[model samples]
Target chain A: MTYCLGIQTHQGLVMASDSRTNAGMDQVNVCRKMHLYIHEGERVFIILASGGLSITQSVTTLLRRDFDQGRGLASAPTFYDAARVVGEQIRRVGEMDREALKRDKISFNINVLLGGQIAGEKPHLYLIYPQGNPIQATEDSPYLQIGESKYGRPILDRGVRYRLTTLEEAVKFALISLDSTMRSNVTVGPPIDVVVYQNNDLRVRRYRRFTSKDPDLQRIQFQWEHSLRKAVLELPDVDFDEGAEQVI
Target chain B: MTYCLGIQTHQGLVMASDSRTNAGMDQVNVCRKMHLYIHEGERVFIILASGGLSITQSVTTLLRRDFDQGRGLASAPTFYDAARVVGEQIRRVGEMDREALKRDKISFNINVLLGGQIAGEKPHLYLIYPQGNPIQATEDSPYLQIGESKYGRPILDRGVRYRLTTLEEAVKFALISLDSTMRSNVTVGPPIDVVVYQNNDLRVRRYRRFTSKDPDLQRIQFQWEHSLRKAVLELPDVDFDEGAEQVI
Candidate 1:
């Protein structure tokens, strides 16, 4: 299992992915799930993937092989076209491996969060499904998440707004969301890969890898625990029935 | 879909369940998910269920049928015995319906949280699985949740301590957990049934149903949104390379 999130905010796009992969509780390992495609001055694309590592790695290998053939992401005409190329690559991999995977009782599962900026287009984000189809984030739904998404979705629902205007703040918010899930679930862990893209920028401006010992994240976790206790205590007590005292 | 949580604290136990039921989005309706069985001074048992409504309702009916036949919860030798009774009831229902459900390509999915006090034993909580087997909550693991549980599990993981000594605080914390999930997922909604049982008291003292229009809940929701925004803004900004500014 993995947890990966991508947000397209007014300021730009932010992407974060956890590094843990597990077949079962005893069979867990670290594998970086974020793939970076950059053409320094012309374009930059970050794909955060989750699900069957075999399928995603095969898709990545296929994409890299195409790039080696000189039909890379940098040469694509638009972000949409690049996304289409990525989808085609996924399809190719599926065609080659899906049957064997099914025979082994394994799923042809891989979901990707693709976010990037090209020279002439605005920064955009998309959630690519296992079927190779994709959904772009809209103003009403500015975020996309895959794999162990439920634990972190509530924060995005209540806390994320279209008005958030800074990429730095968006990054912090994304970390907090991930922090909540990390605390609860053992399946998701650090080191986490984070990339921040600003509007109209054709490259990733800020990228960081977060480990469990990161001081900033420690502080955030501490503060969240404290604030939650304080918040719960502040709520008014429910009125009790007349004989309620008898139970205590 | 539904969301229900049970927390065992120093003061007693807190149990809450949502009222939503749906075959699909268009077929959604409200159905009470919390069942209370009290024999006044002898025993007090609360069962919060989620999953197939028909299955859960059938289990409830079976329990009541047993009670009517004089094998009631109050007559159970222990709280553990009561849980076994509940599990047996679920098994009976599953036996009756599993084949039909399978024929229609439907799952026999059902999960329940059972918690309360019996006359002679300490308060206890158990999470009953679809297979009818159950696991009791321990001091190290003081809570159990079912149905749409992932979204709300983080708070209990991060903030719930055995030192939490009051039902008021416990219920408030549980509500906050539910609020987070309800905001993120449309499948879970109000009115929510909340029940609190005090330690050594063989009766439920406080039970309330909350709706979206509840003023106190609205205030807490507003405050949570406010605090999360403030928390995000307080994080330090990520420093980036000079050339990176052009891309973001």
Candidate 2:
């Protein structure tokens, strides 16, 4: 399992992923899930994946090789085309591995978040399903998440506004979302990978890998915990009216 | 299709549930998911349910009838036995409906959280599965949740302490959790039902059904939203150092 999310705010995009993967309780490992393709000054693509590790690795590896040859993401005219290129690779991998995985009772499962900007287009985010279909995020829903998403989703649902949240704030929100997930689930953990791309920058400018002992991560976690408890304390206390009807 | 949870603290227990049920996008209704059985001064049980509406309704209906006749929860000697009684009823319902549900491809799914005290025993909480097996919440993990649970769980993971959280705080946590879930999921909505029972009280007391228009519920929602936004604002900003290695 992994936790990967992308926030598309007015100022730019914030993409993040945890570095933990597990086949079972005893088979946990730290594996980076974020892949970047940069044709600097023209286009930048970030792919965060979750699912069967081998399948995702195969897809990314194929994309990387083609991208290096300037035939995949590098040559694609738009983010949508790049997404299709990714979907094609996913389907290609499915054709190769799906049958073998099914024989062992393993589903051909994988989910990918593709976020980037082409020189002429606005920054965008899309969620590519295991079936090789893609759906883009819109102003109405400015964020996309994959893998162990729910525990961290309430915060994103509440905090992210397409036109209101700045790139910095979105980065903060993304980290906090990942933190919440890590606290509630063991399979998603650090060192965390984050990329913040400012609109029109055409480059991955801000990136960080936060290990468990990073001081900044520690500060954010401690501060958020304190604020939440304080927030909970500040709420009005429950008052059970005397002789109230017990409806339940 | 529902959200329900139980928190057991040293001071007592807090149980809560949202009241929305939907068979499809167009078939939505408000149905209470929380039920209580009380033999004043002797024992009490609060059951919060989630899953197939017909299946849960059948299980609760059976429990209510048997309790009124003093044959089930009413006659149990301990909370564990009470949990067993509930599980037996769940199993009975499964026996009656499982095959038909399978024929129609609808799962015989029902999950229940039972929380209360039986005379001489400390307050306890149990989660009964579709298979009629039950697992009790322990001192280390004092809260149990079912149905649309993940969105509301991080707060509980951070705020609930078995010995430290008072019943008042537990009730507040339960409400906030439900409010978070309601915001993220349409299938979990209001008229929310909540019950708070103090240890050894042996009575059905302190219950409220919060309609969407309920002022207290509104106030809590507004306050929590405000606090969360404020908390996010207070977090330290991200500084993207130039020349940072791009790990992604």
The sequence of per-residue lDDT tens digits that candidate 1 reaches over residues A1-248 is 89999988888888998989988899999888888877777888888888888888988777766766768575789888888878877788889988998999989998988898888888889888888887899889989999988888877886677666467777877887888777778899998778888877676657777779877767767776677667667666766453333221
Angstrom error at residue A30, model 1: 1.6
What is the lDDT, from 0 to 100, of the residue B47 in candidate 2? 94
Candidate 1: tens digits of C-alpha lDDT, residues B54-97: 99999987787777676856578988888888888888898999
Q: Compute the lDDT of residue B99 as modeled in candidate 2.
A: 99
- Model 2 stretches with alpha carbons more than 4 Å out: A244-248
Model 2 Cα lDDT, one tens digit per residue, A60-105 = 9999999889898889988899899999999999999999999999
Best by TM-score: 2
The total number of steric clashes, by the backbone 3 Å criterion, in model 1 comes to 3
CA deviation > 4 Å runs, candidate 1: A241-248, B238-248
Query: What lDDT does candidate 1 reach at residue B42?
Result: 83
**Fnat, one value per model:** 0.52, 0.68
Q: DockQ, per-model, please?
A: 0.49, 0.69
